[model samples]
Target: MVGVEVKGTTRLLGLIGDPIAQAKTPSVINPIFASRGADIACVPLQVPAADLQKIWAGLKATSNLIGFGITLPHKQMAIDLCDSLDPVAARVGAVNLVRRERDGSFRGYQFDGRGFVRGLQAKRITIKNRDVLMIGAGGAAVAMAFALIEAGAKSITVSNRTLEKAEALASVINGDFGRLVAKAGSPRPQTGQLIINATSLGLNETDALPLDPGLLHPGMTLAEVIAQPEITPLLSQAQARGIEIHSGIHMIKGQVDLIADHICELWS
Candidate 1:
């Protein structure tokens, strides 16, 4: 890992979210910037939901602030603050990364889903024509659903504690694709070829597994979006069953280049 050296000319990039203590973006992103010999620094800023707008406005006023990242509750809220949204972000209605344009305007883009898909592809796991069962219908799930459809997934089933939210997410995807590409379903692992846990179920040690481990089979691929534990309980169980596993770290790693390229453009 390259050492981080801060100078007066170093560019500022931030990861903003409520309860940002657990964010790993800085750890993963700063190294990339250092390795590339770019004078860019990524830091985490804890901003409450009520303070987001004020904080965002203040950040934009800072001349040297090139870009930032949004996580959790902020992803959906950041959409309204952006001057423009990337096509994928507009369709997903969420933004994970924001770049300051040449005109000093902010452009929002969602990379969570794209990162997840790319991570799988990097590991030789194919999503095309595969049946996917995603547990959770929040911002991350929405992004992943659209990406899966875009990547040619045969079908996707969304399951969440609040069935209404799951239904709404499915509706959005179906509406966008003009086909029955997504649907709402229960938490029980179905016959899906790809099983994903996009919820915070595995964030805590005592949290229950998102799906029944007994239902996992050797031919299936299990994935999660929780990066903290690295090896989530769901993935651990899947591993014991000989099921292929994809951790949340891979998702973060996969998007590092995309995020770096976007932020670097400001300096270029």
Candidate 2:
């Protein structure tokens, strides 16, 4: 395992979010940089939602800063700050990774959806032709829904606490895909081969489980996007029922290399 050796000339990369203590990007990304002998260090910064613009301006002024990762409340907000967005980010309506151009302008790209798909593939779980039931209609959920459609999921049923938000996301997805790929549904886990908890419900120890654990069956696959507790309550229940589970750590690991390559390209 290689280690990060910082110096005056080491390049800077950051993971920004409000309440960023749960971020695990550095632990997953820094070692990749070290292994490749790249003189870059990834750090976490807690930037409040109110101060994002001010902080973004300061980040642009730092010549050594190559790029940064966005999380939580800022992913959608960061999209407006970028000069351009990759197709994935544009479709997802969020930006999880931003690359600084030679002229110091920023370009945003989204990896959440791709990361989740890749994580599923790593576990030999196929999304193609499968019915997916996604909980939460937030940025992460939207990204995953788009990715699932792109990956050839037969259909996606999006459920959220707010039915309007879920309906809105489904409309956007169906419009973009030119088909009935997504539809708004109730929070109850629908009958689907794949079930995803894209909500933050599992982040806190006392939070309610995203869905009724009893709904998880032996043949179903469950996945989550909360990385802090690798095995979230929803996941634990699914595991106990002999259901296949994919953790948020898998999503992070799956994207680490892709993100490293993108940032290294900008630096070079």
Candidate 1 ranges with C-alpha deviation above 4 Å: none
Give the Cα error of residue 227 in candidate 1, in Å: 1.4
**Which pairs clash in the backbone of model 2?**
none
lDDT of 1 by residue, 53-98 (tens): 9999999999888989988778888989999999989989999998
The TM-score of predicted model 1 comes to: 0.93
Residue-pair clashes per candidate, as listed? 0, 0
Worst 10 residues of 1 by lDDT: 186-195
Local distance difference test, candidate 1: 0.87
> In model 2, what lDDT does residue 132 have?
90
Clashes of 1: 0
TM-score of each: 0.93, 0.95
